[model samples]
Target: MRVSRTFRLPAAAVGLSLTAVLTLTACGSDNATDTAAGPLTVVASTNVWGSVAQSVAGDKVEVTSIITEPSSDPHSFETTPSDAAKVSDASLVVYNGGGYDPFVEDVLSSNGGNSDQRTVNAFGLLESQSQVRDQGEANEHVWYDVGTVDATAQAIADELGELDPGNAATYQANADTFSGRLKQITAVTDGIAATQGGAPVAQTEPIAHYLLEESSVRDVTPEGFTSAVENGNDPAAADIAATRQLFTDKQVRALVYNVQTDDDVTRDVRATAEAAGIPVVEVNETLPEGLDYIQWQTNTAKALAAALQ
Candidate 1:
């Protein structure tokens, strides 16, 4: 059995010639050449990642997303025989690793992604943790973290270019545009820090904690926030009590909650923050039903603005 570490491919801005070399090319009438010259086929594990892939690959690659809705728990997501078909047929597969979307892992495990196949694990690219160091207080909602994603996008662009050298220029161009957007977001976060100031933020779960942290904002969630949310388990009563105290006692500036991943615990947390007159910034793991990845991220910036203010 081959175990492909999903976190491997990474970065942007290699040589322009390198990207140009990645462009699609006309090949001789050979079986391998025919396959190599065609449009790239990509499958992202979730819709959010699909949107990201779409932003870059555009018409150059055919992208399909299996998990389009946020309501579906990725942990319990069972792949259909068709998904296996998608896996076997795909040239590229993207997933948000770190055990957050183990379904992708399962798919890849069922059908290995080595050498000929390229797979991306967003979380695996980050600083590794033997035991999920950011657990309890910070759930691994990696898509929200700009730093990690910025790197992930670059990795995808480079690898896709490598996959079909004839389309390298297009891939690099897309990569550049996407990288600019990521940087633009960072600039926006900087503006938030400058205008809104680095306020103490509270969260029901680690929903978008990494993003908040990268924005220079501080999180003051009570312990057990991540573990409970990740497993769909209710937080301990003591933790719940402390979370309530955080609003009244610790004086949090705002609360960021996963609007889609709602449950009794998150609801209670939102209520506690609301009752305490704290503003809320709702976040979603999967892009909202109609909104694509970029628009959704733009909305996330707006939410940050509201909460920071």
Candidate 2:
């Protein structure tokens, strides 16, 4: 989720700044002690990455997601003491960086440094792989990008192996299986693009911009409008007018709406799109319940492809 305001440290837990939180290292004790006796404990910033970790780790790891509540806006998520404890006890930590989940960083910092903990920052990994630069300029919803999500799954497997060498082979095998499923998702996206290439779409925000791009859909939403809404600010009057025009004029094939981050403006946009007979495909930042990462992406791709058709 896009963050407009900085998350404040709870009044009881004061004096922690964003810079201080970011500087906290993930490294913990080098003794190779498991956070727990039975399974490796993994903490993810949101259920999106948590689902990926769960798939890669299989039954060998216990995954906990900080943002599992569908109604919660991750941008305004406040950290709790229990969340900090979870980070402190986790053997592996996976988070979407790029300022999308600074609360994760803050939680890690408040729990103190963990030198032995294996960390995977999805945004940082993407940047290292040259997938994106300047998280602010790029879409923070990296999971929507099949290639990036695949890379993140591999990264999670690698970190799991490092944290638990005994399960290294299992991690590799699981990662390979997960990667295959991701490739299938890519093929599905390619198929859609082949049929609906250059189709114009409008979005309330850039939540699924990567997926839309992968499917070769042209997002005609004004950049100013999307940016403003994403940052929790009111869009410029001209941008709002242009966005409404895109719907009323039926210039787009579909409207990809962020179901998790709805507001008055977005509601009106959706109503207008529906009135124009444009299909509205709902997307979310968190993985839906009862579905893993692959399932969620596959289902969304199918819905989008159908809408375009």
Candidate 3:
């Protein structure tokens, strides 16, 4: 996980000031009406959440995602004046909060955004979920956690329903459908847990923390190594040696590699895993081209299962 950059206002020539009038009125405001001329609009920080919003909103909403390219790191993503205007004019803004996408929070705080803008935060939802919350600090990668995504999907539906009362039923129905599909994905991870609970694994970064937790795999990745990588620093030589030992010794059943943030250190770790005949499963922060959220996660869960086998 890369650190989120501090957001700064774009130049005035970019037209941020013009978006002040586009602010979304608070939900249930007495004078409020559907603010969009066509379908309702949802601006999401990344395509992963954008895909979820679309599933619940169906055809009644137009969704725009800021980080659609897989190569773009969400943490270091720079917001444009156009992005601000999109959020300002949107009926709902969905983001992975919890420091995962600071740019979104920055855009919300600038003059163009409203404090009352209807927004769905995945990390915030995770904290509120008693079923999922634990004593440990929660992972900011909530999208990989099935429970959080399900809750977020429902939250999006409720917000959309409130914004467009006539389509409330449709929004809710879509959420139900989306949740049901999520359960199917959960079942796959549950099966992995039931069959191979506590299987040892290692990761290049902590990006798949929740996913591995759901599958009941014991992650043996060195905290020092992952922390250093996440903070955009190189791991200490001792930590690097220890991580390589895991691969050379074949202590872990598989290596979960984040293909997005490649570096010489990670590449060597991956190469070590391959030389030892340990399965290397590549993971990404965003959806792959031609795949939706469900398909992408489903593939990840199954790939882990296969690697373990």
Q: Which candidate ranks first by lDDT, i.e. highest?
A: 3
lDDT (Cα atoms) of all candidates against the true structure = 0.68, 0.79, 0.82
Cα lDDT tens digits, model 1, 216-251, are 777867658645664566778888887888776647
Candidate 2 regions with alpha-carbon error over 4 angstroms: 1-39, 131-137
Instruction: Give the best candidate by TM-score.
Output: 3
Q: Give per-residue lDDT, candidate 3, residue 30.
A: 21
TM-score of 1: 0.81
lDDT of 1 at 270: 80
Estimate TM-scores for all models: 0.81, 0.87, 0.89
TM-score of 2: 0.87
Q: Write the per-residue lDDT of candidate 2 for residues 1-309, one digit (tens) a residue.
A: 333433222222324453343334223423224644546788898999988898888998789998998776666676665566566667788998877777677666655444555788887766776644333356667888777777888888888887788898999899889999897678878988999999999999888988887888899999999888887888999999999999899999999998887888889889999999999999998889899888898999988999999
Q: Comparing candidate 1 with candidate 3, which one achieves the higher lDDT? A: 3
